[model samples]
Target: MIKQVRVVLFLVMLFTSIVLLSSQTSAAAGAISWTKPVERETKQAIKGGTHKKQEFAFGDGDLYWIHQVTAGQNQQPYVVTIPVKGESATFRYRAVAANKQPYWAQVSLRDVRVLPAASGFLETENKSVWLGKPIVYAALGKGTIDEKLTLAPPVEVKKTAGGYVLQVRLPMRAGLISEMWALESAEPLVIWGKESLEQIWLTLDVTDQAKWLYDGYYYKSPSTYVPYTETSYWRIPENYVLRSFLYTGGSKAALDMGYVMLKASLKQQEQQGYWKSLPRSQWLQNDYGISEGFYDTRFNTGAAGMMLKGCALYQEGEFCDAAKRYTLFFQQHAVSNHYVVEGTRPGWLVADYATVGKKSNTHVSLNHQLAEINYLYSSYLQFGDPTDKDLADIMLGGIVNLGSRWIVSSGDLHYAYFPNGTFGRTDYPYLTYNDLVETQRLYKLLHGMEEPTIGKLMASKLAWMEKNKVAYLTIK
Candidate 1:
């Protein structure tokens, strides 16, 4: 009898301790929780569509709506879009009611890592596409791996007139590289966190380069995505085996970094034999018997060319040379004379204007590629080697001369495309983040030159795309 009583008492004490610990843990850390999925919908009715609040591991302090925007029969626009804060790795919470019902909650990035302090926004000329503010990645010097993993301080935002200021002081982690990296945004958002801090996981590649290259955008390790860096701006092909996004959401600076990797690849080509095109990694097509590729594919021509043109504006000798090669190289990537790009993933392919509808019925990012290459080719001609004007003209002409029908206009608000060309009512969406600055700069640069009336008119359209953000931006 006494033994039974003792066992019961012990169990009671253990239960009390567990309850106390649970209560204390809940009291600490401002975490979010939701039981049931909250009912939500988009403000617009689409061409006729609905949006649902899909809880996901978006970026820090972020939420998303996973929707199937059906424009017509047999066509479904299944998209997972994040908030104005853009993309962030986040833990999602959903409750049918407030905190009253049984909820579903996840733990990942709280999305607190996104957004910028007004002072730290993309500090660049016109806040161009794919620009990187100078960031120094410091590796873990002499600490145990455990010591490097510590919590960082908080990130805060303050509002003023138009926009508010964001303040962030994030920690760096160390792993394979000596240094890690950060991102540059079209807005003033700053990202620094405990996991990516230099004191944590940092490493240098085989050539002694810093590990930041592998520390890509969404913290997707180089082992996953083709190119490591800010993958947040774009996504890998669903066919790819990547389980995580190296970088989440749209980041212009990350695009620029990808460009740098390409230039470096060109320089390294003469020195190394493995990467004839892909710099730090390899470009492998299951169709070809090329050397098996590496996990990092950031230096592909399409991505690289975009970065190269942006760099050509300033980095003269080496930058210009690399940008030129990248421009021509992009020509090699098209399918059947169209500018649609191909690489590790088919979805990553960017096609020439009007190609998406005329070529096939599949939903691909053809316009996205057109918008990217149009600016890149134009930028190279205007800023870099003037000798490459003929080459630029050829490609730029291809992008613009897709069809003769009147398309929607490129406004400061959104991208416009040909509505009457029989592609249905598809409108050219605005290229926010990196795409905007690149297009605008390229347009203005081209506008300054003597081109055909159509080209000049096109340049005017891009200018509107550049300035349209004024209405949406708080301008802090």
Candidate 2:
């Protein structure tokens, strides 16, 4: 009986040892093959750094990395580059700190674009695999991964003790091309050995080979409420539209604009002197995964400013009260960060969740700042409020600090300054015109004098416009 019991115990111990060995070997191998698709585009904050850039692709597609280099508060232009598929790239993501703190090296994905990541426009080959149909395998540290595919392609991620291995096999197919770049981390981790990693990336295979595609996991672009064809142009920057009407549209048009303005004023009054921006169409949020129901500062402040102008012109009590109330919100809520007046929505193009009672970083806008400065100065003049003067000075000082960056050699103002102090494109000539007009208005409000430099620049642009037969009407 004792011998039989010992034999049973020995067999049980052997089986246990075998199972334990197998489990340890599997963990050591670090071979985690996920059969289902990890379908979601998300922004995750990293522990080492704040910003991250991660890119992943399935199958043998033309892979590239899109990197956003953020050096301190100065936001640089996104650097898009084509990286060799299955190669390792180093990222030195900087932990941007004030007081000169130590930065760390980490890998991350900056912006999260959906799976079967698209290739660049210049690349002729189609590299992105079918959406929601990728086989993803995520491994922690080091090991050799061999993925054999039967009907679909193989996506492998091998992070060895010494180095890394990423390989994607593509099935033969036609019309499988991509015209967009995926997430990328610039190699060498450091540009000039000083810039820190704003982001980094690694390849992962998380596709469910069993199911072709799940219904809930797929994402499609949002359909436009207002569609635009090749020749279509949405009349954005409505300030320009209003100015255009003021310039070319006759008395009837002016009266029509006045009615529109009155309607807007009524709406503002209805909402306690605050503009209620429209929520993004349901399809937009549901389909495109974009933020909806955001308010624009430009519209809010601009409407209030226009109402103030109306009050000054017609001596209307309601207009004056609305203007004062709207402008007063800024005094209470606007955050002064060095020279930048943050927390206030500055432009129509600058959208924020403030409409939905949420806060976002104050986006800088040169044109909006100009308008706000003019409004604030006017407010100070009309109401004799020192707060208005202080606010105007802070915004004006920030703009003046931009100097040549915002003002071209011809003195034509650039369209805007991004929140990171980067100069946005100067595509809108009307923006410069508006800036000139606002500068003149602000100067007049401040010192009862026209800004001569701005006047000269406006004249310069106007003459060129006339010579070239620009469609915009003259503003004197």
Candidate 3:
């Protein structure tokens, strides 16, 4: 009886010890503390500036300090000390406007390892002195203005004897900048007590890129038209938005948002399986010079292709069914109705726009043709349809045969081939290139060989773009 009583007591003590250790571990994980700048000193005051310093106690029991200098100029410098306790750390900085005016700032992080959590457009070439390391910089800007955001080049990084200094460009106006730091190997989805590390998963600035969509604008009212520009509410395609969410590691929140967008896009499909082009009179006047609703082949192909992708990604049968509907519509109605122009080449030249209750627009944009070919080829691979492959090959032949006619003097491909036998206008440099690359990839997968013509055109366009330094040129 005494032995039994002693065993029970020992078990109770062991349980008590385990409980105490668990509580201590939880407390250590949850602890986060920080201190604001103790002193603010007026700098040389070129246009009125100040230097401030602050310290933070990251739950890992290390001290990180930020010494920032803000001026009324385009460039501000932030020096952050690396924690001595760990081999690496991840930091997030956000800048917002104080007033209602448009605010913009670019942050360049230096001395830190470039992890996948660094979400920004990384510069390939060292454009500035601060961009020497594996530099990833975020361009943060927000406003109600309809103008496109023209981002300045990344500022250079300077490492002083004291620590690593990052050059930040201040907005033209006053703004507030917030910073969050975590361990380098921290799991983004894991909530460290009250501090959320969710932003690390995003590869782009969520606040500036598609902010409205991410903020549940479309989820709230899927049918409501959101203005993209002064004339169009449908500039960014739903599929592109969905793709962004899916490509960014597919977090639960992102997948949920993607599902909402996929369903919304599926609901917007017409009975004929084609999404109608912009019906807004302003968009029509600005783009096509006609107010009639039409079926844009390029847009339709993109939306349907993305639907197919969503179906595969989310394993949703409804998305696949919708995609099949579009494929059937393209084969039966589009092909049977002869909404194509007989090209000088071997294959049937697809029309760019099929107007509602009106004659189809026969202008053949190179990008549009390539996009349809890619979609058809992808569909063939997915749905195992021989007709899709045949059509893709036929259209691809037209592109090959009509080669030099599309090539401009500068070796860049002409945007479109009008019915009047003239090539005019300019497409975005990378848009057509991306379509060509995808087509080549799909073709190689199907045939186990590379198409020389596609390769040549891709090389030519790439050369031209590199020669002209045509980075970030958004024509539309």
Candidate 4:
């Protein structure tokens, strides 16, 4: 019996030793794959130091903002070359920070379209970036990654209270594509040495026990809804918002914008003397996201959101209270960083969730980011967060740094974004749908600031709105 026991022990020890060695070897040969898919088309933030750029695709709708380069609040430049289909386009993302680039990085596309994760846009011999620029082949390439990008299965999810909850362990293989850039390849391929781990290859994220996203890094959350739906876009809510993968269009904040404003309106009346704003029943005014329960005007529009919140702060008179109360409401609900969606209207354009950026159906590029930042600044003035001023300053500084990057405006601080500011000089003739209001909001926002120049400009703009009988800042 003693001899048999000894032999068994030896065999067990030998097997254990082999298994341990194998496990250690596997561990040593790898790093975590699948980072957060943060490459969206927005204004990107760049750190002061040197870094490489990451390239990826986006669904066509509006742009989204992803990627974070935080160089302790100064100023830096970020240049991205978007390759769509067979054509390549480039844009510069510039920012200025007081302590760190608070917000950074943007992904861009043109006339882009998106479909579900399981399947969407893919051709027999194609894998282009956002601007139709064909990908280059590497010496040891594994062909195309379109199918892998398009056909990758999603981790199943189920809904729960509190928010959609998900715990995922992504595969390392999913993070990489076999190097396929060939010298002979005619496509706009990667010129070796530009491969940057910082600009992660695949835009995905993983969840685990201890540490995870939104822990310490400065980042922005995607919006309440999406026009370009992707497994990636949906992933944020699935894992963070709740424990379920299905939204069913039944979200916690499912009130049509108007109704939500009513809650804000009560706050507005209690603070600001102005109890009502003009009727703005143009497009989807009376409709709430849910049933036939129509939401009143004092709640939904960006103006109302800010006005109500403003009132809660500056408990002074009409302008003071109305502006403060509404400003706060708008700040809380400013769109998410994710903009690309897959469907059509009825499913309108949206914006980012937490951080300030382009809100869908509102506008695109500088137009939205600038307006939201201005609104946030107004809230800062009415409320008490000095930090908001810092953020707003960074945004404005970034635009100033970009100088002629955007198109020239017809009004004070209003500009267009055509190749060299030569697009349209006559008040931009065509004020994109969400233009006037945002610009007016910016005027009111700056007027609240301490700066003389910006304040004066904002005042002049306000004058223009009234002079034009424009329903500019709707809070009145």
Top model number, TM-score: 3
lDDT by residue (302-347, candidate 4, tens digit) is: 3343343324322324434555554444433332322332222111
Worst 10 residues of 1 by lDDT: 237-246
| lDDT (tens digit, per residue) of candidate 3 on 1-476 | 01121232232222222222233223222212322212222333434444444333334332223333444444443334332222222233333356522222334345543322222222212111101111111212221112223332233344444434434442322332212221221223222223222333322233333222211111111122222343112223334445445433223334444555576678678777877644333443344544534566766786797688667666778888999989887775446433333455466666676655455545677887898888899899788989899988888887887766777889898887776667787755566776777788789999999888898898888788889886422211
For each candidate in the order shown, give its overall lDDT on alpha carbons: 0.29, 0.37, 0.49, 0.28
| TM-score of structure candidate 3 | 0.53
TM of each candidate vs. truth: 0.31, 0.40, 0.53, 0.23
How displaced is residue 136 in candidate 4, in Å? 62
Ranking by lDDT: 3, 2, 1, 4
Runs with alpha carbons beyond 4 Å of true place in candidate 3: 1-239, 248-250, 281-292, 336-345, 471-476
Give the TM-score ranking, best first: 3, 2, 1, 4
Question: Which residue window of length 10 is worst by lDDT in model 2?
Answer: 209-218
- What's the C-alpha lDDT at position 308 in model 2? 62
> Which of candidates 2 and 3 is the stronger one according to lDDT?
3
Error of 3 at 63 (Å): 36
What is residue 407's positional error in candidate 2, in angstroms? 4.1
Clashes of 4: 94
Query: Per-residue alpha-carbon lDDT of model 1 for 1-476, expressed as tens digits?
Result: 01121232232222222222233223211222212222233434433333222222223322212222222222222322112232233222222236433233332223344332111222222121111121213222111111112232233433334332334332222221111123323442323344332111111111111112222221222332233333111111110101001112112232233333333344433221212222121222221223222211122333344334334332435544554554454444333324332222222233322211133222223234444445355545546655344444444454345423323444322222222223323333232323333443455566674334234434444556456542222111
